[model samples]
Structure formats: structure tokens, C-alpha cells
Target: MKKYLPLIILLFAFIKTNAQYSGALPSYKLVSGNDWAKAKNYYLLTLLQQDAEAAKLLKADAGLAKLTADKIALLKSSLAECKDALCLPAKLKFTDDEINTVAERLAALCKPGSALDKLIKTHIIPSGTYFQFQTLAPAQLLEKAWRQDAAAINHTIAVYAEGAKPNYPQIDSISYNVKKRGYYTLMYDCSAEVNETVNARSLFFEPSLKGALTYLEVNERMQAGDYEPMATTVNKPAADKVKLTKWANYPYTHIVVPGAGPDDPNTPFSGEGMLRCKSAARAYFAGKAPFVVVSGGAVHPFKTKYNEAVEMKKYMIAKLHVPASVIIIEPHARHTTTNLRNDARIAFRYGISFSKPGLIVTDKYQNDFIMNMDKRCLQELGYLPYKLGKRLSDTELEFYPLVNSLQIDLDEPMDP
Candidate 1:
């Protein structure tokens, strides 16, 4: 019996030590249908409580340990429903002093074949350790060290809402090629009889002598001494006439003047000015090019405008005797930028090359912006199978200056 006394005492000590190490880590449950931020807040509170209990255990402070343990128990009971649970050693609040103290205590308690020993082997060593201690068994020191490290990580995450910006892949370069080109012209809202109050819907010129006379004036002013009597041939003195392979007319498509919709009865003829302008452009291009590209689409979601291209094609066929097969209707373009990009793509598909000069027919006022966009599109095409040439000659520069003056003068009254 005397010889067996030491073994009995050892067993008792073992049982006593293990008695204190009861209870699982607080279970974290996210509230259902809650946003991530709210869930994270709940999770953080549980973790903070765990940290406090773990700290108390390291100090061999029974009163502090009991207090923290009670708090953790309460939290665990209150948790809604946890899908999964992780068991972790109690950790004190993250602080330099607390970490050092916990590290030292963990070293002292570490031993072979102990709970701490298994935890260190299973969780800590595989990951890494932050606290340094010589006397403690290295194999059993990980759990406490890991807890300290995790606490620090959490604190860091709390300080910065989001971490670091990630690096993205870089594009090396870009290339471009010009596919095709053809004659282009601009039509305008002009009247020889009288200056008209051009609104959104009002056709600037009637399909009569008045309209024809206005077109003539615009043509004469633009061509000056260079005006040809009829669309005879490509007669620019700079180059010999090569056989014309193809011809297309691209119209500005739509013009929506401000204050011209269902809400504005007073501006009943709001779009008329644009429609008239487009008509003139169509007539001019029909006279110049054998094949014309009509470009326009639906104006409003519920309503449709006379597609500038369709109307122009009709005018060309009915009035000018051009063949229906000569016109290509591109009705999908919604904005000026998209119109250029889509047109360039179409031109490339049709074998239009930079070797041939392309003309952009648009409103005189919008000529510069369209020309700039065209140049950008060509640049995007890069060095391709053929060269593309672009010339902006249809829209008179004077009209743009006049439009700018009008816009500025009306700015104050037009502000919503």
C-alpha cells in the first residue's frame, strides 16, 4: 500500500487538472437573413469573450478564469444555431503584455501526452507560432501561441475594414487597321425663304422647291468654286480616277432637341428640325454616292421615329431613282460613339480598307466630335490587312459655331 501511494497521488493530480479543462469554445451562430456585416459583428463579440477567458487561464488566476468562463458559457447558450464549431484554447484580449504573459504560462504547462501537447501538435506546429519560450515543451506550446496570434490578426482586421488592393493583369499593347471607305455628306435644317424656328419634329425643308433650293444653297456654300454640277465621277485633280468598287452613305441618324416629348405640348414640333436635317443629308448623299448606308433606330422606348436611314433610302429611291439594293440599313446604333464603333466594324467586315478614302456624313455641328471618334476607331484597328482613309468634308464648320452660340444663349432658361 505504501509503495502504491505515489501512483495514487499522481492519478488524483491528473484527474484534478483535467477537471478544470471542461466546456467547448463558444459556438458562433450567424443570424439568418442578416447581412455579412451584422453576422461578423456577432462573431467578433464571441471571439472577444473567448480571448478574455483564455487570458485568465494563463495567469493561474482562478477568480478571473471563473468570471470569463461564465461569460463564455452564457454566450454559447445564447447562440442561435451553429452550422459548425471549432474548439479553441481560451485567449486573453490581444495586447503585447497579455500575449507575453500567456506565452510564458503556456510554456510552463506544456508537457508530453497532455491536452496542450495534442493541441500544439495538431493545430499550432502545422500553422506557426508567435510566442517564444525555452523551458516549455515546444511540441505543446502551439495552441496558446496560436490563440495569441489569432487575436492579433482579428484586431488588425478590425482596424482596417478591408485589407490590401490586389494586383491585376496588365494589357501589353493594342493594334488597329482601316478596312474601307466611301463618299459621305451632311444634310441640314436650312430654308432659303425664311429663317425657321427649328424644333425637334419640324422638317427644316418641305419636299418641294423650297427644300430643293435650301439643299442647293448648302451645297454651293460648302463646295464654293469646287462644286460639281452633277454626281459625274471622282474628279479630285489630286488623283487619277480608279474604278469605284463600292459606295455607302452613313447618316447622323437622330436629333432630339431639348424640351420635346409627351410632356411638352408647346414644343410639339421638337424633333421636326432634326427630321428635316436628316432628310436633307439623305438627299445630298443619294446624289453623290451610288450606295448609301442609312443609320438610325427607335427614338423612345414606347415610340418610334422615322428611321433616318429608312426615310433617306425611301427619298433616294422614290425621288432620285436610286436602286433599293444600293442602300444598307444599320438600325441598331443608339449613340454617336456606338454608331462609329459599330460602323467601323461593319466597314471592316465589308472589306473597306484604308487604301480607300471613307467619308462620314453627319450634322455640320457634330462633325468634329464624330471625326475624332472615327480617328480613335481607326487607331483601335491597328496595322491590319489594308489602310483606311477618313475625310470630314460634308458638315460646314460655320454651322457648329452658330449652334454653340445658340446653346450658350439658351443655357439659363433651359436649366431644369
Candidate 2:
């Protein structure tokens, strides 16, 4: 049995890595700095703007120049025949040849000593603190990230091209226009087109480029900046406190409390949520870990103003008598998958030791579900955020942080 232990561990890892993540994910957000930004904005313009040398090379390159011109011409020609935003996506989406040309131009910039290589080293590489993209060559990493962004932009074109309807239509408090035709606004007025000249670069990233604009307009959360610069916003005092404490003495790095959103629309925090928070507070007092991370976002009951993590933190402090200095609030995870992933992300970014396992303290049902959460994580997050270790008890399980948790999932823009 002792000799077979190594083989058992290898088998578990093998099963996890091979989990299927098929089809294009619904959305994407590229990491600009510490925060994730809209993928469409980044790829279409921001990337070039940030790296002037690389931008100059791409803009000057004959391939991109010709591709841009051709795409602009195509869009200009189609504008007269196109009736509305719905008719423009087919004209604006990248063709295989155009994509290949763009890829080639970007590939040129990945060479050693090039401007893009420098940008990659300084910006892209450092964004993922855990060296998430170390396995991929610079070119491969750039191409993969760019392609995913393109796919996300294209997806928005298809889903929100006509215009997105509000996710919660039944709620009367939301305006009629918001309820009926979310993001009815457009970048260009298509009401009666006689054609003004479109910018070459903008033309190069059409339909979805337009769709990305509408998506942001509809979501209206492009700039909420909820708990951003989390290094300072939520983790500062706790991180500072942790610095003076001896981590080796604790059995766990942190006691993670994944938020259980309220079922009632008007309710800010649920009973189940309190149960989870109480469990974590108990673990903290017992010296299970040095910190308590309450993980969640504005999710349940759709468009509810209350944030689960924020509410939970209040509960723990006011009700449980938990010290504010020892609690970290992760207020941007919309789902159970992100709850775990975001918790791990907070742990990694806040100087928590990945070598030390974190204990997840939740209700028995959630704890049991977590034991089989690998499939769900893979399906939604494309990789397991943490490696599941031993189950400490009925309501507590141990998990080690994974570097791959840094890989941003753009599907949930509000939280990503």
C-alpha cells in the first residue's frame, strides 16, 4: 500500500490535467496590470498604445497595413447594404488569411531584443505572479492569449450583436430600455448610413469590436473598480499582520469561507452564508490558520446590489467578533468555481505561502460538492485552481494553491 501511494497521486494528477475544456469560452478579459480589462479594447488598441515600438512595427508592416486597408474597404462597401448592427458582424469578423497575417506580424515582434519581448517580460509575464505562462514560448503565449481575446470578441458579436436583453427582465426597478434592449447604443449611428470614413485600425476589428462596445454599455460595470488594487484595498492590514506572525506554527495558511449567496432577493446574507462564516471564524480562533478569506461577489438573485463577501465580512466582524485585521474579503467571484479560484488568487497575491495548504470551511453539502468539484472547475475555469488534499473533517477540506489560478477567465467580466 505504501509503494502504491506514489502511483495513486500520479493518477489523480493525470485525470485532472486531461479534463475537457471544449469550445470557446463565453467572454475574456486580458490582464492590463493588476486588474483584468476588456479583451476587445486591449487587443484592438490598448496593446499597441502601451508598446509604441511594437505598435510602430505592426502599423508599418506591409501585411497588417494591407490587411487593414482591405478590411476597411470591405466594411465601407458593405455599409450601404447592411441594414443594422446585426448585418455588420459578417463584414467585420477576421478572415483566416487576415488572422494569419496579423499572427505573423505579432510573431515578428516576439523575437529576442524586440519591443514586444520587452513588453512581455515587463508587463505580460509579471502579471501572473506564479509564472503561469512559463511553459509556453513567448510567441506561443502571445498567440494563444490574442486568439482567445479574438474569440471572445467574436463571441460578443454573435451573442450581443442584435443587443443584449437584461439578465433579469422580471425586475421592474430596472428601466424599460434596460429591460427591453440592453446596449441599444452603438459606436457609429447605423440609423441611416450614407458612410463617413471609418478608421483603418477600428475597421480591422469590426462587428465584435462594435459588439464589445455594446457589451460594456450594457453591463455598465466597465469601471465599478470593486475592491481593485486588492493589495491595498482588502489585504494590506491582514498581510502586514501576517508578516509578523510565524506561518510555520499554523496548520493551514488561511481558513477559506466560500460565500453562500442569499436565496431571497431582498436578503443581503443567507443563513447558509452565516453558517459558513461562523465555521471559518471558529477555525480561525482555533489557530487553524492565520487569516480568514471570505470569497464571493454580487451574484445571487441576479443584479442584487449586495456583495456576498462584503456582507460576510461584516457578519464575521459584528456577529462573530472576528478581528477586522485578520480577515480578507474577495468580492468578485460570481460562482462556486470562482469562489475557490479567487480565494487562491487572493492567497497568492497577498504573500500567502503556497507551500502551506489552506483549509476550506463550508457547510457539509458544499464540502462534499467540493470533493467532486474538479469537473466543474475544469469546465468553467479550464484548470483546477487548487490541488485537493485531505479532508480534515465533515465541513473542512485542505487544498494547495496552483499557479494556474492566475490565468484569468474572461467569461465573468464583472469579477475577472
Candidate 3:
């Protein structure tokens, strides 16, 4: 009960923010989908925490260490004083010298025969192969990770701050809700008792991190072991089914249906969403593929209780009579980019062959949107999640999944 206390309170407290249109709080387990509790989705932080020698190197540099502490303190001060999201980033941005110094120290591990290099090769690189850290010199990788981590932290704070508009529609409401609670306002006073509870659950006060990084991690206590081993919970049957599947018999490995979330808060599934599922079900019945992969998260009209994939799977099974075994629910992707990326991850991990192309079944408008989204995918995800093959029809586009889609995205923390 003690360990569960934080989660219980957060579940009830944050749940209402959904009604008011704020986005869901970050869940680290869902973000990284691994047991990386300390670092969550930040690879550089994981490297340091796992290596005592590396942590010691940072701590031993009195100047850098002091600077780190000072920066953290400064962040706290700024949070107390900040009036808007725009000011937080300017206050927290890391200086070039600080980044270079830390990079130089950590890069020492990159020596060809060093233990750190070996760890990066055997552990880190495989953990996120899509990061393409292997292409970088050790120093370069360290610097890049450090800079990205710093920027990510700052970005989260800015998102949380009042008056900032996140690209994600509902997130702005979260910023508004937090401000209403007096979280970022100078005059809003919290009692010691309330402060203790806030430390356990608030984005600004997660127990595992201090200062701005706390904002980056979000709701750590509730997120602990949450949705971990996601493959086991969400897709274990599909994974098992894939083991016995005869891939050569099917023309395609899977039929993917990207979820269209309902815009109205009271609605469970959109008409477009139902149509998309119907389309995939039609393809499945046509013997187009052995499985239908539904991709989406609880993202629509700001933190609606409905999850797009979960609702779509229910519709498929109940209405369309699609077998439960053949419908794989990927209930994490928020955008169309992640819809493809996460489904590709499903394909790779669940024994679907990347060699065989998968067919995407969606409305003609969405199909056109997807085909022309190369620029958007590259801009947002830094790489394409799939290799486009051909246009089989207006409703179908042929695509081969890319392994790079497995890379964790820290930028989009909610669905990373």
C-alpha cells in the first residue's frame, strides 16, 4: 500500500485534468518500454548512472560539478519566478562550455578498448540502434546525448509553464491546469503537508529527480514499473501466434490500421475510426494479411478516457467478428508517424518479417497524407519509420518496416 500510495493519488488527481483538456502525464515505462528506471528514456543519464567510474569523473570535476549544482539551483529559482513558458528555456539552456566539458570527460570512455566503449557497443547501441550512435565518435555521441537531454529538459519545463502552446493539442490545457493549481505562480503557497504529496506526484516534484530534470521525467512514482514488458501485456498472444505463422502463405505480413481518434469528448470511437477498422477488417477477410495491427493511444479531444487502439480492437472483434488473436493492439502511438513506427516495432518484435511488405489500410485522404508525409516524418522523427514500396490502391500503400523505428523518441515523451 505504501508503494502504491503515490499511484493511487495521482490516478485520481490527474484524471480530472483529462476532463479539462490537459494531456496525460508522462509515463516513463511506456516511454522507454524497458527497466531503465533511473534514466527512463535518456541514454546519457543511463550511461552515467550505470558506470561508477563515469559518475565519479563528473563528481570529481569540482568546477563542473559545482556548475551543475548551481545550474540546478538556478532552475529552481527560475521556476519560482517564471511567469510564462517562453522564459523557462532561456533561463535553463546550457552553455557551450558546460556541454563541451562534460562531453570531454564522458568521451574518455569511448577509447577503443575501454570498458565504457564496450558497454556502449554491447548494451547501449543495441538498446537504441536507431539513434545511430554507432556512427558517431564517442565524444560526439556523448556531446549529442548531453545536448539533447539538456534541451529536452528545458523543453518540458517550457511546455509546463503558463502561456506556452505545445504542438500537441491537449498539452496546453495541462499547462493551464498546472497554473490554476498555483504550481508556477509566485503567490501560490502550499502547506508542508501538501508539498510532501506534491513531491510524490507533481511533474515539477517527482521524487527521483531534482529541479528541471524532474519536469523531464514526470510522475515517476506512478510510472514505476508501469506498462513495463509492454510486449507481454499488450501483444503476448500476437507474439506467440507469430512463432507458428507461415509467412510465405500470406502476401503481406500484416494489415495496419492507423487509429482516428474521436474529436468529441463523449464519443468512444469516431465514424472515421470505425470506417478505418472496417477497411482493415475487409482486407483481413480478403486474405490480404494474417493480422490487423491497430495503432493509437488515448489521445483525442484532450485526455479522453478512450484509447484509440483499444476502442478499435473492440469494434473489430465485436462488430466485424475479427478474431481476437489476429487483432494486435498497439495502444501507444499518438501521431501517424508513431502509428507506423510502433507497428514496425510490433512487426520486428512479434516475428513479422521485415522482408515482406505490410499493407496500410486507411481512408483515401489519410493514405494521401501518409504517402506525402516523408518530410513530416523526417522533420519530426529524424528518420523514416518505413520504406515505402508502392501504391497498391487508393486505400492501400505497400511499406516495409524499418528497424530504426524501434528507437525511443525522447522528444515526444508521452508516446516515446
Candidate 4:
């Protein structure tokens, strides 16, 4: 009981805060399949306390609880399972000519919007961010395992949807507005087995049924690259036309400079913010990058009328005598997470491929911390913020959209 105190308290707080809502799950067709998953999570969470009495109190359905016990043990072993299909197998010919051709071909095929890209993106590419999990499991054993996980996924999604139910005939769009407690539903561990061929389950989504099923088919296709007739290209939008010749102002890939908070009345330019801008300008002049992307909104201490990104760009122009044209200001990100997100949005808008990680320009400590932070920050922001439509760059040019994400929740749940 003591061990479960925090979760118990969190649940109660969640309930109390959301009491204004009807406290009823939405009546979507897929929501009906969520009960078992819900009960199993209750069982597993209670099971973790190691108190048989508390487990009994969860009152999770007998069947679900029993199944959950076995699944929980399996989860532990799954982590150490095979790491196959993660990368391409070794080459057949060591001769430079043959291997290089195959390598180049495979690399081209796996390009951002190639015919054979990573299978996970195929799932969400259909509906952008809104989706529900539907099982397309290959076998009975996997189906059973999936049921347990899906139930948990559905349970969390139901809570989130109920807490902030969208309007009827919900418009298809990405939303990260869900409450903090339901953050677990953001991504499902679709991998029923550790060695599951396609790991699309690791990607984040709204954690609903259709979304889950879309990725299931994607992962299933990963082991054997057989994309069932229309599995990967179902509802994805067409690629944005990119006039690459004139889009970029520079010849080489540039550095991303995410802005820190701005100063207030007493402090004209914050030490932290100035340091970030100065570092970015120094790198720009050092020939490390062709240009610099300075990103941030009017933030810090709130409502003071100082825009972080703009101020940084101004500082760079004044101190380094760097041409103003070399700096791009994204003036709407209020935090470090959005700094990356808005940068991606700006990149996509300008026909830039964010697939290549930029040299993040900031002080050493901030650089380390930003690099270490999980990419799930994208999930928390409710969209990829970069890749969505088909590849815009032409055949001669290669573009890879940023696709790395994690399973963590946000430090600040509300950003809008």
C-alpha cells in the first residue's frame, strides 16, 4: 500500500481535476475493446506493489489479472531478446564496386519517402497523428500478447479522450493537449515479442485503436519487407513541391541555434541567452555552418515584450558583424522542446531536410542536456513537426526527415 502511494494519489488528483467531465468514455466502436487492457494495467500496477491484498483491491477481472501476471514476466525477458532486422545484414561481396552499389541502392531505398522506408512511418503517414489501434497480429500467441498491451493502450486513451473529448466528427489533426497522467498512452509497446521484426510500436501516437493497428501492420511488414498492397500508402498526403534550387540561401548544411530566455528590465541581455547567441555566431563565422537558425518566441518571465530569437539575431549582427541574411529567426517557440519543433517546422516550410541532425549551437552544458533529452518531445508536441507528406526534394538530391523519438512524457504538459 505504501509503495503504491504516489500512483494512488496521482490517480485521485487526476480524477478530482477532471471531475467536471461526464466521467464516461467516448462511444467510439473501438473503445469497447479497451476494458481488458484497462483491467490488466490495474492488475500489473497493483502487482508491482507486491501486496496481494492491494492486488485483490484492484478487483481487476480474474482472467485479465491472471493473463497480466504472465505478460509482466514476459516484458522483462523481452528487453534482452534478439536485435535482428534492426539494421541491414552484412554484404555478400567485399569488393568495393559491388558493395558500394548495393549500399547506395539500399540507402536510397530507405530514404525519407523512398518506396521502402522504415516501416513505422508508414503507419502514421496515413492519418498524420489521429489513429486508433487495431490488431493485425500475425499469430495467435502474438495476438494474445497484443490484447493485453492494447487493453492498456486503450484504457489510457479512453481516459485521455474522456478528459478532453474532441468535438463530434473530430477533425484529423495532431494534438498533444492530453493531460499528464495519461502520457503513457502516447506510445504503445507494440512489440509483443522482443524480437518482433518491425519495431513500429516504438513510435508515438494518440494511442487509439486505428493508430495502433496502422503501426501493427507496419511492424509486421518489417520482418519481411512485404507491404500488403496498400498498407503503407493508405491516406498519406502528397509531398509538398520543393524548389530546391532557390529554397536554401546557403550551399552547405547549417547549425540550429535554439534560444534561451530573454532578459527583463534590470538585465538588458541575459547572460544565458547572450551566451547562446554568441556561440551560434562564433560557429557560423568559424565556417562550421553555412547559416544559423535562431529559434525562440517572446519568452522568459512571461509578457515582458522581449523576443528571444529576434534578440539573439540582433546581438549576432551587432557583435559579429555577421550579415543579417545569414540568420533565420523562428519567433514562436517558448521552450527548448518547441525550439527544436519550430525549427523543424521552419525547415519543412523552407524545403530543408531535417533528417540530418544539426549541430545544436549553445553553451556546453545546455548542448549536452538538449542532446540527451528524449525525442518524445515531438510526440508531446502532438506531431512530427517535420516529416508528414511525401519527399519534396528531387531525385538527384537526398532528404531525410527527422524521425527519432522516445517513450518519455513532457516536463511541461501544457504548451499551447
Candidate 2, residues 101-189: lDDT per residue as tens digits?
A: 66777777679887777766555554552234445777766666666556555544444443443222332112223223222334234
> Which has the higher TM-score value, candidate number 2 or candidate number 3?
2
TM-score, model 4 to reference = 0.36
Which portions of model 3 miss their true places by more than 4 Å? 1-40, 50-64, 72-96, 170-173, 177-226
lDDT of 4 by residue, 245-292 (tens): 232443335566777774454444577877777766766677755557
Q: Candidate 1 lDDT, tens digit per residue, 81-153? A: 2221111101112335434544455555556665456544443322111212212455444444434333433
Best by lDDT: 2
True-vs-predicted CA distance for residue 36, candidate 1, Å: 41
Q: 1 or 4: which has the higher TM-score?
A: 4
Once model 4 is optimally superposed onto the true structure by TM-score, how far is the C-alpha of residue 55 displaced, in angstroms?
A: 51
- Number of clashing residue pairs in every model? 32, 0, 0, 13
In terms of TM-score, how similar is model 3 to the real structure? 0.76
What RMSD value applies to candidate 2? 8.5
Cα lDDT of all candidates, in order? 0.31, 0.65, 0.64, 0.39
Give the poorly placed runs of model 2, Cα more than 4 Å off. 1-36, 39-47, 69-81, 88-96, 129-133, 162-213, 221-225
How well is each residue in 154-255 modelled by candidate 3, as lDDT tens digits? 454455433345557563233245535345332122111122333211221121133234443332211322344656777677767888989888999999
After superposition on all CA atoms, what RMSD does each candidate show versus the true structure? Answer: 33.6, 8.5, 12.3, 23.6
